[model samples]
Target: MPSPSLPPELLLLVVEAVLPPNPYQLLPASHISTRTLLALTRVSRATHAQATRLLRQRCAFVDSSRRLADLLLCMPRLVPGLPPVLSLRHLTALYIAPFGASLDDLPTAVWVRELFCEVCETLRRLVVQMPFGSLDPLDDHLSVRRTLRDGFEQLHRLEEFVCVGEYPALSVPDGHTDVWRLWPELKRLVLFGVPMDSHWLWWDIATLPRLEHVVLARPVRLDAVNIKDEYFHKLPREDVRLSRDIKVVLMDLVYDLGVVRTERWKEIDPEEKMTVEVFEVPLPFYGDETPLELVTEWARRGALDGSVWKLDATKVRQEEGSDG
Candidate 1:
């Protein structure tokens, strides 16, 4: 007697069960699911198709150089009769995390360019974690910067763009303003900082046709106090009348995980709430968390609007004669 085989749907469900929930993590060890999925692929032809589909859907687990090399190697060359094992066109989301080295290395840069070219049309979300000092305006990094900028321009279908690890508030030459205009479908943008030299970038961001949420995870400028005055004064009222939501997350200067500030612009009109809500954590929290993590937590629980929040740091500080 032969053993019974499982249905394709059930097999795919099993594959999905083992996949990592948060694929954006930087540590390779966190993606133990990668091994499990690879094992499932070897079970049979039916299992290979289902497992490979999930593997190609999100490429966030490729954290190290060796994994990246293997990903590229899996791409099949144009053969007469054989079907492609894995297709880059199937990918919809990608996370690029440059750990310690620059993405400008010869092999790595080539891989980046090729990967971008392959997924340019289909990719809808991108999260980049650049190592600090990687995007500096030095002659050595000019070519790599151009490659990255060009790659950004090619992603017409991109909806969400998140860049962590460092501030993107560079000079006009490397300004994110230039790169953002190309993404017409972009809806959510998460950045560490915003350029304070001028108001044009902020206005430009608001003007985007589909943009709705702008999260400055850790703004060096535009604190809880100054944003109420300094931020809106700069943008042209006529140009920024369009409705949009902007969130500014600031950290306490002295304490590690002290306070989280979120300012939301429900509408362009100044008469609206337009208030900054502060979250005072009474319980001890993890010190290793990033600002983006906190922002995500608030967003997940629908606490971003500050309606249920009790503490208002801006008013409390003002009453105490302390500036935010």
Candidate 2:
């Protein structure tokens, strides 16, 4: 008996089934040549459909210095028949670099469900590098805040937000506050290199019922004249019943070699005001060798004082030495 000959359509189907899901890895396979790929597309309608879906799903565009804007602008023209990979329901995550082009360049119809915008937001998870300059330029700062707010308003199901830049001021405007209100489902938040005086915003954050974790880094110190305790009074108490349901992690970096002071929260009853515990930890230099150790020691101290706190020493140490 003779063995049956495999049809071209069946051969393509077998190749597609065996190829890696990622195009970068699959391109090196035997049947991945341009002629073979074109033939596979023509042999069966199912093969054609699967190939198109796979190609679009694994697509990635990386532009380091914002020059990719020109190429991105030409995508629709160069591939007029192909649909955008960044449709509203399919987009899960996006990452951009510091000097990348703005999202305003993208068509408004293009929707991203979860985005990591490094320069600015017209995208999600907007992560901006802290600019090295004076914070007095209110207009410039306001423009950026407005852009972020606009982007936030568009994401109906945004669940996580991160900001890596220095906040301009403690007094966030009404428009920005309104955008924050829109994100009721936000679960995790991270703010790095933000102004210390912005602690006032913690009051606003307490209103977020679903928030589980809050991480803050490189907080800027406010002058004595600008210090206000009204927001502090609104801060979540240390009591289990009164405490904020979320965990708060703060890492203070010491730029100057000055002594750091810790705060002690006290509960005032009708009879007397008594100190429950004293929380103290040294502020290490931003890039110091034991920065994580310092934070860990602070957290350990907090835990000893009856505060519900835990620290991932391994993660902190690993991250301390990482470029990120």
Candidate 3:
């Protein structure tokens, strides 16, 4: 009599048992243990398939320079009629950490373009935290620039896109137009800490046919007066062409007081057939939560289905010493 074999479905569940609760959160590479995944992949061909998929999904969290370099150096190992290694082909969502050690020596542009090329057909959500000085590598090489642009154009299926940094990710040196038109299927776009000159992004926003929500955000501080000007001035009332209503959300995070203070306004452009709504929400909490974490969570929730507006009731103030 032959020994009984465990079903593949059961094997997948066993493999998933080792995954962290929130695998997508940015965590230190050392904190993540892959010994189990490696052991399982060596167990059998069936286990290898399942473990490979899990590992590929893990690449979505590009948290450190080492992790980014690993991804850049990864090569695909395809099994007959099966998914390849480095799991780029199976990826659907990605998040780039907002803060980390400077990754200057790596070919950041090639890595980004390679990932984009493989996942362009499948990726639905992307959150890029492009910190100051991060964009220099991408703009340094001419061939790299063109290839990156081509890869960007191929992401037609992406639904939610977020860019957060001191400078706009899409800023062009020569002032190119209609760049936003590339993502015909984009539904939600979130931009934070955008520079003063990125007002051109508004023109791109108007070109997205399926765009329903646009979020512009900044941290609340003494210089927020200038921040307000930079964000508000981007909202143009003219030449807006849309068949249905779209909402533009402006948010400001007050980190010191553990509050998110927001103001919403509604602008009805009759000639342009677009309705822009600015929603005001003030949410306070007590914890070690960071501004980037809070904003990323807010943007992702709203991007999924626009249910972020339901947090309106949480706008009420909670007293400092109260235990309620």
TM-scores of the candidates are 0.68, 0.45, 0.60
In model 2, what is the error at residue 67, expressed in angstroms? 7.1
Candidate whose TM-score is highest: 1
lDDT of 3 by residue, 12-81 (tens): 8889887766545322334443567767777877788777677655535676556666765554545565
In terms of lDDT, the best-performing candidate is 3
Clashing pairs in 3: 264-278, 264-279, 265-278
RMSD of 1: 6.5
List per-prediction Cα lDDT, in the order shown. 0.53, 0.38, 0.55
RMSD of each: 6.5, 11.9, 7.9
Could you give candidate 1's per-residue lDDT for residues 84-111 as a string of tens digits?
4656565777766534465445456556
